[model samples]
Target: MYIDPSKKPYPFCPGCSHSMVLDAIGRALEKIKADPRRTVLVSDIGCVGLSDKYFNVHTFHGLHGRSFTYSCGIKLANPDLLVFNLVGDGGCGIGGNHLINAARRNIGIKVLCFNNLNFGMTGGQHSVTTPFGGKTATTPSGSPEKPFDLAGLVSAAGGSFVARVKALDKEALDETIAKAFQHEGFAFVDIWEICTAYYMPANDYKKQQMDELIASYGFKTGILREEKGREYSRVLNSAVRFQTSDVRRQTSTTLTATKFSHTLQKDSIGIIVAGSAGMKVIFAAHTFGKAALSCGLHVSQKDDYPVTVQSGHSVSDIKISREKINYLGIDKPDAVLIISQDGLKEVTDILPKLDNGAVVVYDKNLQIPKTEAKLIPIDLHGLDKTVHATAMLAKYLTLNKFMPIEALRSAITAISKDKIRELNLKAFEFGTND
Candidate 1:
């Protein structure tokens, strides 16, 4: 449906499926002839927020985990306007608490979630919808835990109308979008879009794979009607059913999958770190750690942590051989530097849960853990260490042989020489490297 010249190119990364999903939304809008003046789009973080710049309709990038809440407010204030939620799986799934509460209240809003299966904005990290064994920047070793089924979860949460569509199926996507918009109460359409940037063999390879899949598989489109005796009927009815009680089951915390997983990783350590700052951590790995594999070492970051949006806690790390640990001990960290009491707590809790011991380094004087390991203190109290943190850490690694001098120097020089010298001596003089 996206004609060659009609397709507008933006700053989207190569192979991103967001443009396709956006096209489908536009087509559905055209088919329905929905009044753009009477429509307000509420979106959360990530590329979806870019809708404000792309579309002529009113759009708002709501706070994390609060898209539906904002949409609910918009609809309640001006019942004439059609409220559409353009969000990612993380925005609606990981940010699902607000979404469900809104649905239970029968907020007259429609949610169009582009389920790209992983985070797209801050590099490709895993989301709640990331399929098991899928590869991502965060899940290089593949995802360990399974993905949550979003359609079933919406149905269970009493969504009025819920349907699943794919980016590859334009007709189905168009139909699904129309049905979701036509619904009376809270409606959800899960757009299973592909992250061409993250989850595919190159574009050519993926095109072939897509061709094969399309050749073998058949797709059908229809509206999911709530049955008479079904508990999910409060939404599509003539009136809003604000009868939501303590129906908060264990399922509320669970992330559900709406389609088969499309992950492809076959390694150990199916670890799923957070995103946001975690993106930097993963970038550091790709920039530094991938070379470690040449030395016959292995590493992988997976997707199996908290959050369900395009942006949140940034996370990334790698699994390495304990046999050649230069800095961090193979069994436990030789020393764990505490940026705050929270870091101290995170390490201490894990020490009790792991087979090793860690020397806790604290900035602020705090009660040390009562364990056999030593507790070293460092006074980084008033150091302006943010800009030079990586270089300083690199210098420490160089001094301790945690990394090769050449590699550490390369990473530091990537910053600046003055920076390297200043922070290196600062860290060494303060004995923060201990």
Candidate 2:
């Protein structure tokens, strides 16, 4: 069988009902003769995410609450694949709108939610699915809001099949999951997972207490709704026209020149400058980006700061690449410039990804700790930290012969105002001299 029965000793809390849920899912996969190569299981964040390591089939651990969205793309790309998404109540609750819309569109996918009534990973805080009067870590005084019928909501939103299952009822739960897999369109199954660790005693919810609480709130079990709905993949397959084997590939001979041609750099570099407000981090990124653009290099930059606007946090992510850059977000930068202690703290996590060989330039006066990246510290030189550090970085780049000196000079002259133009020119020369 493709599903591994011995995959656990599960990581769930002691007495957690997730084992039963996993059993039913495995049995369902067996009933359908699920092939490991054609199957992809997506796991949402929280306890359910642990299943990614347990599954024998191809799988991808998804962003918090976004497994279903990722599934849509995967299914759209290859309709023959069987994709299963496992989510916790918090995953669907925080991103409830995505759940309803996925059903409404009847995207070809099967989604199972382990509704334990709270965010399990974050200490059992009250989630959208938490029942009224159920107390959680956040809801110390019993919850006041009523929980929604997750199955009914999906059905009404246009899911082709919707069911509710109890973890304890293995035979029936397995049968229900099998039928959901057989459905041709969107399928949603809500499985009850008991939170044995915190929820049980926090709300005085023992086995019998759970029965009464659920009954009082009126949640149903078994198939709640089953009907035909439009399958997004089926419709898309019929609508799309493309050659199955004869694919057209782009070639330089067939390509046209873009206006950004001259700005294209032979090689690329990424830099992130961060610090508090009034440090001119943005100015530094702009100066460098403009210089790269002048050389016909593709440049992308992003800035982030706090609401205080005067002195909190600031970050600028810049990428200068020869190829047409696609994703804009910077993960591991080639270089990082620190202007203040606040900036260093802001990107502490990112600094670890930097290679031991990566360049790290900072203001020496900050007196921050050392790092693995090649450290280049500069004196403030009675000039703005932003300008000084930028000049230092430029000097390093120039020494390494990264870009043309003529290009950098032209950019500095064009960007700087009449008053500061001479000062910036002098600074550029100072950087090379050092």
Q: Per-residue lDDT tens digits of candidate 1, residues 1-434?
A: 21233336755777677888777787888788888888787888877666656666788887765788888777876666788898887777658888777666666688888878777787778888876677777888888877777776777777777776667788888888877776777788877777777666422225455445334434333455443222222332323423332233321321111111212122222121122332233443343343233333443433222365333433333444423434321234343334434334445554443323434334545565655644444455555434222322333333334334444333333444586446544544344343
Can you give the TM-score per candidate against the true fold?
0.48, 0.57
lDDT of 2 by residue, 1-434 (tens): 65565776778888787767886788888898888899888889998788776778899887888888889889888888888789998898866888889899898799999888888887989988888878899898988987887887888888888998877778878998888888878899988778887677787666676667667767777888788867888678756634422222221111121212242334567788878787667776777676666555677889989888787877888888877788788767878878778888888887767788677777777755556787778665766554664575566566445556666666677653775666666767767666
Query: Candidate 1: worst 10 consecutive residues by lDDT?
Result: 254-263
Candidate 1 residue spans exceeding 4 A from truth = 1-7, 202-222, 226-434
Best by TM-score: 2
Give the top-scoring candidate (lDDT): 2
